[model samples]
Target: MSQSASDQSDRTSPVKTQSPLILDSLPDIPGVEDCSLRVQQKIDLILLAIEALELGGSEYMLATAKELELQSIVDNRVALWRMRCSNPWRRSHVRTRLTLKQGKALTLIASYRARQLTVLIRQLLVAQQQIQEKGLPLEQHFRLSDYLERFRAHFRSRMNPRRAKVAVYLADENQLNDLALSLLSQLLFCTGTYGLKRLWVSLFDGEVA
Candidate 1:
C-alpha cells in the first residue's frame, strides 16, 4: 500500500521545538543551605571576587555598577539580582532571575567576606612566595596554620597581598574541610586535617609500586 503525501510530510517534517536558554540557576551544592540567607551568600561570593581581584573602594563599587549597567554601586546594592554576584561579570548573573531582608545582610557580608578572603589570600600568596623563593622553609617542622600566622606577623608592614584568589577558590573547589571550618582554617589545611593525617599514616606503609 502506498502511503499518502500527508503521511510522508508528517514523518519527514522536522519537529518544531525550541529549548529556551537555561540561564537562571543557583548551584545546587550539596551542603550549602540556601534560605532567606541566600542573598547574603550571593553577595558574599561577589565580595570575595572583588577582594581577590583587588578592586578597592570606588573601583569595586564601579565595577559592579558597570557590569550590571547600573549608574552606581548604590543602585546595584539596591537592585539585587539572582545568581552569585561575583566578578569577571560574565559569571555573575543569570538571564532572568530574582532577595529577603537581604539588604542588611548584603551590606554586612560584603565587607566581611571581602576582608576574610583578602587576609586568607595574602596568607596563601605569602606561603607560595616562601615556597618558590626558599623552598618550603619550616613546613616540615611546623603545622601549616601556625607557620602561616607566624609568617604574617614576621612582615613589618602590610604587604599588598592582592593577587588572584586561587587559594580561596581552590578550597571550595576541592571539597576540602567543611562549611563548619572557617575559610582561614580551610586555607591553612596542609596539616591537622583528617586527610593529611591519613596521608602521613600511609607514608612508610607501602613501597613505591
Candidate 2:
C-alpha cells in the first residue's frame, strides 16, 4: 500500500478517540443542595437538545419552541375554562382537567428554564475544571449570597430617604355629650396617651376655659 493510502486509512478509521472533558467540582451555593438530582435531568435534556441542534441546526430549536408555545396556549385555555365551572361533579371534572393542563404547562416551562440554567452552569463548570486540569490562571467565582448582597445594596441606594409619621383617630360623639365632665376626663386621658401635639376645641352655647 502507498504511504499516502495508509495515511488516508488512518484518518478515516472508525475507532479514533477524543479526550472527553471532565468536570472537577461544581459550584457550592447554599440553594444548590441536592444539586445532582435537580440539575442532572435538566443537563440531560439540554445535552440532548444541543446534540439535536448540532444535527438539525437552528431550525430544530425554533420548531421546538413553536411546538411548545402551541401546547402551552392550549393547556392554559383548558385550565382557565375548567376553573370557571360551578356544579360539584362538573367542577371536579374540570378541576382535574385544569390540574393536568397546568401540570403540562409547568413541566414545559420548568424543562426549558432548567435547560438554560444547566447550560450556563455546565459552561462555568467546564471552564473551571479546565483551568484546574491545566494549572492555568483562576477566575473569580460569584456565589448566590454575593449576588443577593449586591442586589440589596443597589436597591437600598435607590430608595427614598425621608420618613413620615402618621396617626389614626376613632371618636364617638354620643357618649361625650351625655356624660359631660366624665367625658371630659376620658378625653383628657386619651389625649395624653395619644401624644396630642396641639389641641383644638369647638363648643355650642358654651364658653371655653
Candidate 3:
C-alpha cells in the first residue's frame, strides 16, 4: 500500500483493548457505591435481629434495642448522605434530628426509606409469637413477590407526582420478573422528571440489578 493510504488505513482502524469490566461486573464489596451502604446495613441488621429472635425468642429480642438503634443509625446516615450528595448547603443545614416524641410520630416515615427493615421487625415479632406456640425455622428469606407487592402498594399510597417520585430497588431475582419490573418502570416514568424519581434498584452484591 502507498504511504498515504497506509496512514489513512491506520487512522481509520478500530483499536482493541481489554480492561477491568467494572461496570459490567458486580462490585465485590457491598455498599461501595453511594446510597448502598445504608441499604446494606439495614438488611444486615434485620437479618441479625431475625437470628437473635430465633435463638432467644420475643422477650429476649425486645429486651435489647440494639437492632432498632442500628436501624436508626442507618436512617440518619441515609439522610446525611442525601444532604451531602444532592442538596445545597443551605437546605441541608436544616435540622434532621428526631426528638423522642417526633421519632415515635415518624415511624411510618422511617418505614418509607427502610421498608425491608420495618417489615422484618414486624415479621420477627410475629415469628416470635408463632415460635412460642410452635417451633419454626429462624432464618427466613422474604418472598420476592411479597416484597414487590408491598413496595408497589407503598408507592401507590404515598406517591405524589407533584411532590416526590417513587424509587424501587430490585435484586437480581426480582429483576428477572419482567412483567413486574416493567410495570415499575412505567410507574417511574409517569411520575415525571421535575418531582422525585425512583432510585435505580441495586443488587444485593452492590451491582445495578
What is each predicted model's overall lDDT from 0 to 1?
A: 0.33, 0.29, 0.31
**Pairwise TM-score winner, candidates 2 and 3:** 2
For lDDT, the strongest prediction is 1
Ordered by TM-score, highest first, the candidates read: 1, 2, 3
Model 1 residue 175 distance off true place after TM-score fit, in angstroms: 19
Candidate structures ordered by lDDT, highest first: 1, 3, 2
Clashing residue pairs in candidate 1 are none
| Model 2 Cα lDDT, one tens digit per residue, 21-140 | 111011113332222222222222222223222333223333443455523222243333343221122212222222222222222332443343444435444554566588864334
The Cα error of candidate 3 at residue 78, in Å, is 12
Q: Give the range where candidate 1 is weakest over 10 consecutive residues by summed lDDT.
A: 18-27
RMSD of each: 18.5, 31.5, 20.0
Write one digit per residue (lDDT tens) for candidate 1, span 1-209.
11243234435662222111111111222332222223334344333333333435335554544442323113354344332332122234343322211232233334333443455555554654576587755343233444334323321121222323423433352222222124333333323323223222232233223
| Model 2 weakest 10-residue run by lDDT | 18-27
TM-score of each: 0.25, 0.22, 0.20
1 versus 3: better lDDT goes to: 1
